[model samples]
Target: MTNRIERLNELDSYGVLNHKQDEELNDLAKIASLALNVPIAQITFVHDEFTFVKANIDVVSTESIPGRVKRRESFCHHSIKNPKETMIVNDASKDSRFINNPFVNSDPHIRFYAGKPLTTPAGNPLGTICVIDNKPRNLSLGEKQLLDILSKKIMAYLNNKRKLLNQENKIIDDALRLQNLTDRLPVGIFQLDKSNQNNLRFKFLNKTMKEMCPSVNTNKSSESIEILFSSIYPDDKNRFINHLNESFDNLSFSNIQFRIKKGNNCAWFAMKGNVERRTDGSKTFYASIRNIDNQIEYEKTLEQIAFDISHVLRRPVSSLSGLVNLVDTKEKLNKKELLEYIGLVKTVSTEMESYTRKLNDIYQKKKEIITNHNKSYT
Candidate 1:
C-alpha cells in the first residue's frame, strides 16, 4: 500500500526484524492482554508475506504463540489496511470477509477481534496490536480507546530502538571509511600508548605498518619501542629511544630520521608526530612513517661531493697555480725544467679526473634508486 519497496526500505533502516524481544515491548503486550481482558494479545509487524510477532501474551491455554506466521493467518494484516483508524470485528463468524478465514473456521476460532494499526512517523502502517477473543462480543468505547493508546506506546518504544541502532551503525560506518582512506596512503599511520611508560603499545596501525615491519606482531600489546629499536641499526638505536623519551616527557612534537633493517636489507625512515594529552593526564602519540632511503642517500652523496670540491679539488688547483706563477717569473724556461712542470701537471690532472668519476657514480646510483622506487608504485 505505501509503495512496497519504500516501506520495506524504511523498515530495514530501523533494523528490528528477527531480533530478540525487549522486556519493555513484552510488558506492553502483557498490559494489553490485562486491560482488554482477552485470552490473546500481540504486537505484530506485518510484512508482505509474513506477520512478525514482536511480543505476545496468551492466558487461555498453555499453548505458546509463534514468533511469525503467514500474513493470511494474521488479523493484523486487515488492521494495517486502514492506517488511519482501528479495525474491529464484533463477530468474525458473521463477517463475509473473514467467514472462511482459517483462523476463524478452525484453530484459535476467533469470534471477536480489535486491532489498532502501528503507524510510522511518516504515516505508513508497519503493523498492529490486536486482541482476540473466542466469544462474540462488543467492545466498549473506553476499551477501544485504551487499545489505541497502547498501540501508540508500542510505536514509541520501536522508534526509540531504531534511533539507538542508527547511531551505533553510524559510528561503525565512520570507522570503516577512515580505515579505507588510510589504506591508500603510502605512509604508515599509527597511534602509540605510553601510559604505562614501562610497556609501550601501538593502539592502532594502518596497512603500511604491517608491510613495513613484517616480523613485528601487530595484534599483541608487546613492547613496541623495544621491538622498534631491535629492528633499527645498532648505531641509531640509542638516539632513537632517547628522542622518543624526550618527546613523551615534554609532550612536544618529534621529527627524526632513522634506519631500519629487516633481514639483511636496510632502509631509512623519517618519523614525525605530536603528543596529545588527555584530561586524565595520559597521552597518545600519533605519527606517520615515510620511507626516505633514497632521500638520505642522495644527501649523503651531495655532502661527499661538497667535501671533494672544497678539499680534494683545491689541493690540485693550488699546485697548478704555483707552477704557473714560477713560469711567469722566469724569462726563459729550460727543456728539463719544462719537462718537470709538465709531469707535475699530469699528476694533478689525474687526481681531478678521479674526483669527477666518483661524483658521476654517486649521481648514477641516486638516479637508479629513484627510478626503481617510482616504478614499484606504478
Candidate 2:
C-alpha cells in the first residue's frame, strides 16, 4: 500500500481537487476519448474518502452523485496502486477482481477498462486518466503508446498550472503579512507624493497612520497639505514647510518636531522621512510619525524647575551665604547684632525649605504623568 498521507498531500499540491479547473483538462479528456475510440474518458484525483473527477468526456452522472464516487468503488482507486504502469482489464465481467463492481455490473457497465495512474514526479499516485467502453475490447500496441503520450501531456499541463497558482498565493501571503505587521507598530507610517511642492497626495497609509490623521484626505492633495500647514502651530509652520519642501527637492530628509493643533488640544509629533525617486522622475516620500507629547511635556517641566531654581532659590541662597560671611568677619560682634543675624538666618532657612517643598511637589506630579503615559503604550 502507498503512504496514504503523502499520496493525499501530493494530490492536494495540484490545487484543483476542490474547484473547477477542468476547462483544459476537459479538452484533453475529449482528445483522449476521440483518439482511443472509447465511450467514456476522464481525469480523476483521489483523496482519502472520495475520487473527484476533474475532467470527463461522455460520462453519465446521476443527479444524486454527480461525477464523483467513493474511493473504494472507483476503478481509478485500483489504477493508483500501480503508479508506473497501466491497469487494463479487457473484460471486466470475466475478471475476478471487478466482476461484482457496481460500475462494471451496472450503469456504465464497463466491460473494457484501461487506466494509467496520474503520478507525480516523486512517485506518488494521485488518480488516473482512463477510458471505458461497454464492450469488451483489446488495445493495439499503437493505442497503448498513444494513451501513454496523452497521460504525460496531462501531467505537464497540471504541473505548470500548480506553479502559477503557488506563485499567486505567495504574493498574496507576503502582502497580507506586511500589512498586518505594519498595522501593529506604535508609530504611524505613510507614503506621500513628492513630485512637486503643491502635491501632498498620500499613496499609502498604514492603519496607525490612518487613525493619526483622520482629517487628511487622500483624494485632495493640495487641500490636505493646506490643512496640515494650517494646523501646525504658527511658530513652527514655516520651518516645517521649508524643511519638507527642501527634502523633496534634495531627495533627503532630516528629523523635525512640531505641534499639530488637534481641536482645542495640541499634540507634539516628531517626523522622520526618506524619499524614493523612481527612474520615471516620479518621487514618493516614506515617513514615520511618532507622538512625542509626553517627552515635550517632561522637557517643559524640567525647564520650569531650572527657572525656579535660578530665580526663586538664588535669593535665599545668596542671602544665607552673605549672612554667614558677615558673622565670620565680625569676631567681636555685639549681642544685638548676633540676635539680628540669627533671625535673618532662620528666615532664610524657612524660605529655602518652602521652595524645596514646592519643587518636590512639581517633580512628583510630572513623574506620575510621564510614568502613566509610558504605561499606556506598553
Candidate 1 per-residue lDDT over residues 1-378, each given as its tens digit: 577777767776766677686788789888988988898888888888998988888777445557888998788888888887889999999998889887788767889988899888988888888888888987889988998899888889889988999899999999889988886789888888877544577887777776676655656544465656677777788898999889888988999998888678778888999998877677888999888866776787788778878986898899889989988999998999999989998998998899789778877887888779756533
Model 2 worst lDDT window (10 residues) = 58-67
Q: What's the true lDDT of residue 313 in model 1?
A: 81
Q: What is the TM-score of each candidate against the true structure?
A: 0.82, 0.73
Error in Å for residue 347 of model 2:
3.2
Global lDDT of each candidate: 0.82, 0.81
lDDT of 2: 0.81
Q: Flag regions of model 1 displaced more than 4 Å.
A: 96-109, 195-199, 216-242, 327-358, 373-378
**Model 2, span 1-378: residue lDDT tens:** 679888888788889777665688889888889999887888888889899988878745342234679988888888888888888999999998888888876777888988888777888888888988889998888888888888889889989988999999999999889878988998877777755445576766667664555565534433445645766777889999899888888888758998877677677889999987878677888899888978997899989998999998999999999998888998798999989998999999999999999899989998999889766644
